[model samples]
Target: MPINKQQVRTALTHVMHPEMEKDLVTLDMIEDLIVQDSFITFTIDLPEKNSQLESHLKEKCEEAIRTYVDEGAVLDVTTAVNISKFRDREDGRGEEQAFPGQGHRKKKKRQKDEGEEELLSGVKNVIAVASGKGGVGKSTVAVNLACGLARTGAKVGLLDTDIYGPSIPTMMDTHERPNITTQKKLIPLKKYGIRFLSMGLLVDPDQAMIWRGPMVTSAVKQFMEEVEWGELDYLVLDLPPGTGDIQLTLVQTVPLTGAVIVSTPQTVALDDARKGVAMFKKVNVPVLGLVENMAYFIPEDRPGKKYHIFGKHGARDLAERIGANFLGEIPLEQAVRESGDAGKPIVLEEGLESRSAQAFVELSNNVIQQLAIRNQSKDPTEKIDIKIRP
Candidate 1:
C-alpha cells in the first residue's frame, strides 16, 4: 500500500508542540504535507526562533513517518520560524494563525456580518459551561452534563475550550488521538458515548500552556472551524475560568444558544458568578441558569441533615435576582470528585441512586427543557442591544 496523507496527519497528532501543549497538526503548524512516490515532506510553523525546539519537532515528525509509513519512505521535515506578526492565509478569510504563548500580536477582529456557515453549520445548539472563578467544579459539571445528555440518546460533542487548563482528557478517561477526515477536517475522539476534543489529549501530559489572548482565540476558532463535528444536537464548550478572550471570542464566532454558569454557594463565588452572567448578557448570549455546585454536604451517619458548607442557595438566589433560570444544586460529595478523577463521571455510574449523579441528570434535563423554550420563542430581535460607537 502507498503512503497516505491521512496516515501521516494521524501520526503527527501525537507529535505535540512542547510549549503550546497541543499537537502540531491541530495547531495548523504542519503545512504543505506532500507525499510523492515514496517521499514525504512537510513544513512546521514554529512560534519563535528556537533551534532546540525546531530540532526536537523535526525528529518527532521523522519518527512519526518512520513508525506509520512503510520501510524506505524518505521524510523531509522543514521548520519555518515565525516570532513576530501573525500570518494571514492566502485563502482570504482574514484569519491569522497565532502561535501558542507567542508574545502578544494584534489581529483584526472578525467582521460582524460574517456568517457561521463554514463553522458550526450543522450544530443545532452550542451551550457553554462557564465560571467566574476556578476550583468550583465547572469542568466536572460540564463533563457530567455532556454524559448525561448522551445517556438520553442525544448526539453530543464536548469541546474543552480551556486552553490554559484543559481537564477533559483526565475527566473523560480516554487517551485516543483525533483522526483527520478526507476533507482535511479533524474528527473528535469518542468514548463513553460522547465525542470530545481537548488540548490535554494533544500535548504531553505534564506540559503547561502559556498562551496569549490572540493565541487562545485562534485555537478556539480552529476547534470550531477545523473539527468536523457533524450534526450534533448539543456542543458543550467547557470554558476557562473568568470573562476573557475565550468567552468573548466564542460568542462572537458562533451563535450560542446560552450559557450555564457554575459556582459554589458562597458570597465570593456568587459575586464572580454575577459577573459571569453580566458578561454573557453583554455579548447577547442568554444566561441559561446558574448551577450551585457543592451546595451542601451530608454526613453518612446523619443522612437526613443538610450542611451548607459554602452557604445555602447562593447561586439559586443569584439566578432569581438576575432573572436567569435556576438550573439546580449539586451537593459536595467525595464520590463526585473520585469519579471525575477515575474518568467515569458520576452520572454514568450504573445505579441511579447517587445524589451527585442525580443532580447532574436533573441539570441536564433542565438545560434541555430551557433550550426548547428558547427555541420556541427564538427571536433575533431579542438579542442584547449594544451599538459599537465610532
Candidate 2:
C-alpha cells in the first residue's frame, strides 16, 4: 500500500517531544507534511533550541516513520527552532503556557555563569591549550607551556581536562591524588613550581573511564566548581581533542582568557587545527595563537639541520588564512619524549638548552605577548551564552 500524509501524521503521533511530553501532532510541531510515493518530507519546529533534543527527536521520528508508516519509506525530515516563537506571546499568556524553560533558561544560565566567575575570581587568566584532533603532542605542549610560564615568575596552575585519556599525571610525574580540604575543596598537586590536577589521579592507574557524555561533563563540572585554585596569574587547561562535551562545558563553566591551538605542520593536522580556530571564534574565545609541534626532525648529533618531516609551514599557512597568530614551532627532539616519560616538562629540564626547549621558551613568550595584546584591545571574555550547540 502506498503511504499517505495521514499515515505519516499517525506515525509522528507516536513521537513525543521529550521535554514537552506531548506528541508531535498534538504540539503542532510537525509542519508541511507531504507524502509522494514512498518519499516523505516534513519539518519539526521545536519550541526552543536544544541540539541534543533536536538530534534525539529527529532520530525517534525517523524510527517511528520507518516502523509504523512504511519500512522502506525514504525520509527527509528537517528541523527548525524559531526564537520568535518564544518571544511572541499573547496579550495574556505565561511562558509556561508557551514552552518550558524557553524564556528562563538564559536568565538562569547567566546567573550560574556569574557564580562560576566568582568561584574562580582569584585566578587572573584561564588559558586552554587544545587541538582539533589528538596525537599531535598537545599534552606535552601544555606541560611545557605551564612550566615555562611558571619559570617567568607567574603563579601557574595546570588542569588536565582530558577526562577519558588523561596524560597530565604521567607527564607532570606525580601520581599523588589531590587533597580534600576541610571546606570540601580539592587542593591540586604541586610539582615543578605549578599546581596541577588530572582525572588520572582520582582513579586507578589501569582503570578505564567507560563513561557517557553526561558523566564526563559532570566530572569536568566538578573540577571547575570544587577545586581550590587559589590566587594565580595563569591557569592552563589541557583539553581533549575535537570540540565536544568537555570543550562546551569549559566555555560554559568559566571565563576563558583565550585558547592555544596545537597542531603539526601537516595538511591532516592543519585541517582539524582550522576547525579548532573556528570553534574558538564561534564561541567568542580569542585564539591566542597556533603552535606547530613536530615541525621537523632534529637529530641530536646534528645541531643545525632542519628536516621538513610533516611538510613545511602547513600550520603557519593555515594561521595566515584564518588570521590567527602563528605562535611558534617546536622541533621534534628525542629528549622531549624522554623528559615527558620522566614526568617533567622539557622546558624545565636543567642544562639541556636544545632547540626544542628554546622553541617552547619562545612559544611561551609569544603566548604572553598575545595575551597582552588580546587584553589591551578587547574586554575580558565572558562565559559563552547557551545558544551554541554543545
Candidate 3:
C-alpha cells in the first residue's frame, strides 16, 4: 500500500487547532498540499502571528502523519496567514469567517485571563535578551544588561535559558551548583549584585544536553516555577538563538514586561534580528529595542580613531526600517571579550574611558527610559494560556 493525498488529509484531520477546537482540514487551514512517494509538504494558514501556535501545530502534524499514514513519512509543514480571507471578513463579504469578531475575541480574552495564575510572582519585571542568531554575542549582551540593571540599584536576576548551550555560568564565573531549599526550590547563585541561574551550574560542564522540544519545554518551565527569585525589580532572561520551543514556552509561562534584541553591525545578523522582532510581535511581546553589538572597533593604540569592523549601523538601519527603537551601539573591544571570559561583564569594568563599557551604560539607560514609557502607557501583559500540550 502507498500513501496518497487522501490519506495525508485524513491523518491531518486528527490535528486540531488548540484555540479553534476544530480539525485543520475542517477549518480548511491546509493548502499547497503536495504528496509524492513518502514525502509530504503543506502550508497551514494561521489566524495571526503566533510562533507558539505555529510550532505546536507543526509538531503535532508531524506526529499525526507519521503515526497514521507512514512511519517513515518525511513531512514538511509550514504556516501562512490567510490574508485574503481576513481581508474579505474585514470587508464583510467573506463566505467563511474562520475567526469572527467580538465572540471569538472574547473567547481569547477568557483564555488569557485564566492564565493569570502567575509564576515568578515576586519579580517586578521580566526582560528577555534575544537575537536572530548566534555568534552575534547575544549572551554577552544579556550578561552586561543584567549587570547594568544591577548597577542602578535595582534587584535583578539573570536566567540563562539557553539550555543546550548554557553560558551564564561561564560568563558570570560561578559554577557552584544551586542549593536546593527544604521546599525543593533552587536558590539562584549571587554575583555582581544580581542573582543568576543557568543549566551550566546544574549540570557537568562537559555533558551534552541531548533533548527534544517537549523535554526542553518542561525544563524551562521548571527554571521559572521551581526557582526562588524573591523580590527582584527585574529578571533578565538570556534566550537561545532563533524562535523555537523554549521561546514559545517562556511567553506561555510568564508575563514578560518587554524584550531587547541584540545584533551586530552586519547584514546577515540584522536579517535574523528582523525575524526575532517579528517573533516577539506575533506573540504580543513588546520589543523594547534593538542593541547593535560590535557597532565599531577601536584599537587600544588608536584611541583617537574608530573603525567600522563588521559594517556601519546595520542593526540601527534594521530598527529604523521595522520602526522599532534602536537602543545604542556597543563597540567591539578587547576589554569586552576579556571581561566576559573572566566572568565579569564589561559594564562593571571600572573606567568611564572604556567606550564599550560606557555603551552598556547608555544602553541600560535607554532600556530604562523605554520601559518606563511602556509601563505607563500599556496594560500589564497577560500570561498566555496555550491549549497545546508540549
Candidate 4:
C-alpha cells in the first residue's frame, strides 16, 4: 500500500519548530509535503538561514514516518524562508512607495536618536533567567544551566545582562573582551561550546556602572541588537537581579519564548521570586518553571545526611500557590561555588558527578522535556504544572 498524505502530515505534526516551541503543522512551517508509494518529500519554512532546527526536525520526522510506514522510505527535506512577510508598502501598481505617515511632498528624515532594533538574531528561543533580588545566586544558576544545555548537544548562548554585576564571564571562565567586526557587529566570546556576551567584557573589573535608566537601556539594546549569536538553539539571558529598568526593558523588547525564575529555598528569596513570576505573567511572557537553588545542603562526610540550611521547599510552595511549574532543585554544594570561582562550570568538570552537578543535569533535561511537551500540546497557553519538594 502506498503511503498517504494524511499519514505524512500526522508524522510531521510530531515535529516542532525548535525556536517557536510549536508544532510545524500548527505554525504553518511544513510546506510542499508530497508522498508517493514509500517516498516522501517536504520543505520546512524556516524564519532565517543557518537554522540548526532543520536537522533536528528532519531527523525526527524521518524516524516518526518510518515507524508507521515502510522502514526504508526516503525523506527529502529542504529549508526556505518566507520573504514576502517583510515586504515594504505597495502603491496602486504594487510598486514600493512612501508609507502613509510620511507625506508624498517631502522625504521623511531619519531621526538622529532612533533606537536600535530589537532583533534577537540567530537565537531560536530566548529564555530569560531572572530573580526577585540579589544574593540569590541567580547568575550562577543561569551560567550552569546554559552550560548544561550546551553539553547535551544543544547550541546555546548566554547573555549576561546583569549590567550592575555581570558574572557570566567569570563563571564561564571567559575573560577576553568581544571584538567588533568591520561591519560593526559585536562578536560574542565562546567557551565550553557556548557563546557568551556581557557588559563585564567591555569595562574594567573594578569599575561600577553608575548609569541611569536610559543609559542602561541603551547599552542593553546594543547588546541584544548588535551581537552575532550565530544560530543558537537556546539563548539563556541572565537578567540583572530585581525587577527594575533593565528587566522591564528586556521583557518589553524581546519576544521571549519563556522565563525561568531562580530562587533559593528561603522565605526571603521566595517572596522575591513570587514578584518575579507576577512580573512575567503581567507582561504575558510564559513562565517555563521555577528552579529552587540551594534547596538543601548535603554533607560530604555523611552522604545520607541532608541539611535544610536555607529553609525547606520555599520555592516549591510558591510554585504551588501560584499554579506554576516547579521544575527541580539544586542542593548547596561547595563544588558549585568553587567551580564558579575557577571559571569552570560544574557541568563541564571532567567526570565529576557530584550531587549538585547531577541535579543541574537532571534539571536541564527536565526543562527540555517540559518545553517539548508544551510544544506538542494543543493549547499554547496551557501551563506545565510540576510540583517538587525537598
State which candidate has the highest TM-score: 3
For each candidate in turn, the TM-score is 0.68, 0.68, 0.69, 0.66
lDDT of 2 by residue, 71-133 (tens): 888887767554433344434353332322122222333556544555466666788999988
Off by over 4 Å in 1: 1-116, 203-208, 380-390
Alpha-carbon RMSD, each predicted model: 14.9, 22.1, 20.8, 16.1
Q: In order, what lDDT does every prediction score?
A: 0.76, 0.78, 0.79, 0.72
Ordering by lDDT: 3, 2, 1, 4
Candidate 4 versus the native: TM-score? 0.66
Runs in model 4 lying further than 4 Å from the true structure: 1-118, 204-208, 376-390
Using alpha carbons, what is the TM-score of model 2?
0.68
List runs of model 3 lying over 4 Å from the truth. 1-117, 204-208, 387-390
Q: Pick out the ten consecutive residues of candidate 1 with the lowest summed lDDT.
A: 100-109
Model 4 per-residue lDDT tens digits across residues 36-135: 5566766665545555666777787788778866688977666554332113212233323211111111111122135633266345467789999797
Write model 3 residue lDDT over 1-390, tens digit each, in one string: 767889999999999988779999998888656666676767776656688998999999999998999999977677765454446566887543222111222233445556573577666678899998897999999999998876665667899988778888889898899766545777677777677999767654344366666666667777788887865667899887887666766665667878999999888888889988888888888889999999998788877888998999899998999999999999988888888889988899777668888999999888878877776566666777654464
Q: After superposition, how far is residue 154 of candidate 1 from its true place, in Å?
A: 0.5
- RMSD value for candidate 2: 22.1
Residue 380 of model 3, lDDT score? 61
Model 3, residue 186: distance off in Å is 0.7
